[model samples]
Target: MMGNVDIFEMMANRYDTPERIQISKATADAIRKYLVDTHDKNAIDFGCGTGLVGMNLLNDFNSMLFLDPSQKMIEQIKQKIDDFNIRNADTLCFDFEKESRTNLQADYIFMAQVLLHINDVELVLSRLYDILNVGGHLLIVDFNKNDEIVSDKVHNGFDQNNLTELMTKIGYREIQSKTFYFGSKLFMNHDASLFILDSRR
Candidate 1:
């Protein structure tokens, strides 16, 4: 199994900074546009660090499952759930890349600023595909391809077209993508642009 520990564990206590709150709000608003007939659906916020984006999107779904590998991050989400009496939300600490969860299922799955941290993109994408119910949507929000950045622990970014091709190979259909937000000091204080990719399982 992949080690779930990371810097997020240490940062969980102070992860929800004002800057992240603002970005999460914007990302949630953008994600809301593509969400349709979701009032009766269950959604999973994959790699939901402290539930920033998921918390903004609770009312749109029947229930929200905040999943992250970082236990501290999951604890943060649990505290928020308790603090707000958010009965429709829950948290789980598990790594999708570690194993396939045949019993787990959701009508919608979203990853906001989460994919870059994954070591194996295609593998995790396939794992998510298994977790989604047929006709359900997998929404990914992350930085677009950026060759300027270099990292061994994370991706520089992703090429949307290439991502679409990958999803198609994994049995996802009705794929679509759009550039949603841009910032000068995003992604480690470096200028970066973000995009959202929607694919159906």
Candidate 2:
């Protein structure tokens, strides 16, 4: 995971390129579809990189917590918060793999393009489950199953049904997932599609 952390840290300053920002906006827009009745809840953008996706959703939640393992990414988010004069947004540089589940409680937690970087998907998902309040929701936007991309450090993608089943075993309910977008060179520089999974705690 050091490689993943180092990669993100090095890319923090230049993470918001035009293409990346466009993709982030599209992902954020897709995520917003399932956010009904969430305006009054607190949110955590787990594995948030530079707050690009979460920042697009600040007004949708009462408070936004940008949680990531990369300190440099958190610093970029800090700078964004300061520049925008955002009062309800905060940042935390926390790694779920290295650290136990944190006391951080949120009514909603969303991870965009983040699961692939995780070494242990089940452990991290279960830990995030523990961090959520009852009746809260977890939203994940990740690439759909892809066979072309292969890597030792990251997952190629995920199968929605299998992911839903995994979440069910972890005690999540009302699980629903669907592919929402397709893009060129999206996953590991291979053309890929993205899916959004909504699960309740």
Candidate 3:
């Protein structure tokens, strides 16, 4: 496992930040719309941070498994869910690098801002493909590194061209992307994007 201790610590500290709060709602809404339109009920929030995505999902989804490598983050999420009185929720502290060790399968998976922290993006994508049911959708939201405003070195951003190529190479089809502002600017000066990828047989 790639020592995600710092990542979890970061979440524990900044789980209530304004930027995180704002981005979570927009990202969750976009993801929720895609999942609902496809009639997907069973879902998982991969890299779920302090359950921000889970918080947005509570009203629309009845059951969801929240998975993260950070125990501290999961604890924070548990607190949030408890405060909201949300039920039928579960949390797992495991690494995508070790996903083969777990049995995680769902109709839809929401992963926000987690891709940038991962070094083996392609490998994780394959793992996600393996775990999702047929006709499943994977929603990814991250800052595109190519965007001029993104100043974080840890962020591994992807432009539309590279993202499409990666998804296609992984045997994913029906890939679509949309750009949105997720940070300091209201007009999307930050190069963030939301991707919807459909699993293929």
TM-score of each: 0.97, 0.97, 0.82
Candidate 1 clash pair list = none
Compose the digit string of candidate 3's lDDT tens values, residues 13-93: 566787678778887877766654543367788888787877678556657888888888888878877886777788888
Off by over 4 Å in 2: 1-3
The window of 10 residues in a row where model 1 has the poorest summed lDDT is 1-10
lDDT, candidate 2, 110-159, per-residue tens? 99989988988999999999999999999999999888887888888999
After superposition, candidate 1 runs with Cα above 4 Å error? 1-4
Clashing pairs in 3: 145-157
- Candidate 3 colliding pairs, count: 1
RMSD in angstroms, all models? 1.5, 1.1, 3.4
List model 1 lDDT by residue over 1-201, tens digit each. Answer: 123367888899998899899999999998999999999999999999999999999999999999999999999999999899999998889988788778889999999998888888899999999989999999999999888887776787899999999999999999999998999979766899999999998
Pairs that clash in candidate 2:
none
The whole-model lDDT of each prediction reads 0.91, 0.91, 0.71
Angstrom error at residue 12, model 3: 0.5
